[model samples]
Target: MHLSGSPTRPPRSRMPRALRTLGNPLEWTDIQKTILIFFPPIPFTLFYLYRVNGLLADPTVEPYISRPALATTHSFLVGILSAFSGLFVLWFVLRRREGTHDLFVRAVIHSWFVLMGLGAYLVGPFSTPVLIGYQAGGMAVFLLFDVRRAAQGGLVGLLVIVGTTILERAGLLLYGPVFSSVVFAGERPPDVWVYLNLAFTVVLTAAVLAGTGLAMALARARQEEINELLATDVLTGLANRRGLEDMLEREITRAQRFDAPLAVVMLDLDHFKRVNDTHGHRAGDAVLQAVGEVVASHLREVDAAGRYGGEELLLVLPEAELSGARAAAERVCAAIRALVVEHDEHALRVTASAGCAALVPGQPRSGEQLVRAADAALYRAKERGRDRVEVETDPAP
Candidate 1:
């Protein structure tokens, strides 16, 4: 069965030691991207503010009206306000769990680009090339997302550029008097210089896109490795206890929503401590691994099998009634008993006891309650002598 949740909050105490040393990778990556999205404009805004202050301090440096310093000041303030406001909104949404991190990241990046593009347009053509380059670099950052999302961002950026260009051209045609006074006062650079600048921007964008793509691929690969380590039992290659908890929670919700049958089987190797005392710990590990494989082989595709701690495993069977769960538990017990693990040239055979519990209609129980019932039955199976399956007794009305 498939398990889904926010990657940011993976199960605790299940991650590999190495991964733990690095902290939550998803959260770290999210923070980094958020900073990249919101922090880059601060320096530029500060620089413009500094320049505006200088211009006001001494008008001889450049006439305020001619230099469009006031317009630059306004754009810088708007950018700072937009960045902070967006950051606060995103942080609030994340805290509320109302949206995905990636979704918020995309929104922030897109809005930043749109605002920057508008600012560039307002500042007129002399500054457009440099700002356009910055916009391209911002587009390259979309690589932090998946290929499809990156492509979507790229398309949106292209549309914004085209639309802004068209509007600028149209303004020149329809409102020449007003547009010329605002945007065309500065002496335009040579055509060669403009084209050269555009070419440099394109080349820089391509290089950044390639680098970002590589970095994203590496990050994704590392995340997959870490996820594997977190979810799997090192000894048995089965789902670990934390993974089982996650799966159980999801299955519980699904069953409750659909009013479907669900069962939990708690299995424990009998006389496991004795086995370890008789044989070495390695032999005990081998036996546990064999049992894990046997249990997995006996389960259906919709069933989940996991290691629920030392010498103990759990099975979650969705859409399985009491009888079906009993049968499955019995089968698992038989399979585990039949398992043979060869250690130190000795064929060691092991047996397991299992307890089965199923959800009953009209009786509401949480996933933990189901597991507790199964565990109680498991105790009974142990008391009844190992290598058997016991179903939890149903409560009377």
Candidate 2:
């Protein structure tokens, strides 16, 4: 029989594709999405081992006397169950579709529950101090794993402690053996209930702090991206004037400290306006893009390149001398001459003129002076009939 009133609607499996795109599904990377699935219940298995070791280490403990072999066998059974649950998690991560987000939510919740349950079972019968430490350790782990949304885990951890406290209280009121374990040691009964409450408070406080710190970190990352956009040029993806100045100031100090050479290359597209008039503005933009790409190819990982303004571009070459800077400029000129941009079914070629200047060691100069020296060399290249690299004879000292 059809479940819906309208049989023409067909089954939900045949629903429109548009309806499926309404909600976003959370996704994880390949390693996180695959390998973690098979290892979900690993913590619980280790907890079981710890519990067995605890009992074996001291048979006079309350847990050993209460049930002895039964508790040991129960822990081993939980370990076996965890192994199966791990297999299920692996299958869910790989094959589950259309509800992957919901499955992730459920999986994380289930993992949290198992950790809390294991922790409570392991430490609940122990002295107050040990139980408090155990719960604290669990809270720390949850914070490290998922600090952004840690409140949910914190609540689960609190519930586990509360459940343990209720059981201990009931045991003390009902059976004398529960009280004998704590009080039998001394006059002071170890204050198990107080310790549980303190642990709960500590976990809750840590979760709140973690959430606040995560939010601040995300905010700082966004701010850095915005600043980068403001300091960068949109066209050639190079640093604008502001970014160039910042780079110069930063590199100057390093050059002074290490006594290394630093050089600057100022380049301009020769007869740029003539090219714009002869071809078109679109062609001019293409020429600039091609030149930027060529120069970028020659730059090392530590160097910085940027569009200064209009047809001019700036290059900062650290640990380079005047001769080295001249060589780099020549390479840049050759690279630009080779740039061929496809435009209107024609391969358009362009050439660039370059000026090279090196910073004097142990001599300080303003950023403007350095730019002016490079700019003078650029003009010299233009005066020498363009399309050539010129090195400044007198650089700033």
Query: Which predicted model would earn the best lDDT?
Result: 1
Instruction: Give model 1's TM-score versus the native structure.
Output: 0.54
Best by TM-score: 2
**Candidate 1 per-residue lDDT over residues 285-305, each given as its tens digit:** 777767766788899999999
What overall lDDT, based on C-alpha atoms, would model 1 receive against the true structure?
0.68
Clashes by residue pair, model 2: none
> Global lDDT of each model?
0.68, 0.63
For residues 1-397, what per-residue lDDT tens digits would candidate 2 score against the true structure?
0011111221122222442452111123322333332343354345545645654555455532345443644565475567557656665655545444534544554455555454445445354434544454444344334553345655675676567667767774222222224333545434443543465446545644654454355445446656777777766667888998999888977887888888899999877897688778877776676676677789888888889999899999999999998899898888778767775555777678889888897677666777788889989999999999888887755
Worst-scoring 10-residue span by lDDT in model 2 = 1-10
In model 1, which runs have C-alpha deviations exceeding 4 angstroms?
Answer: 1-191, 395-397
TM-score attained by model 2: 0.57
Q: Which regions of candidate 2 fall more than 4 Å away from where they truly are?
A: 1-38, 43-107, 110-115, 123-148, 169-246, 258-260, 271-293, 296-311, 321-324, 341-345, 361-363, 379-385, 391-397
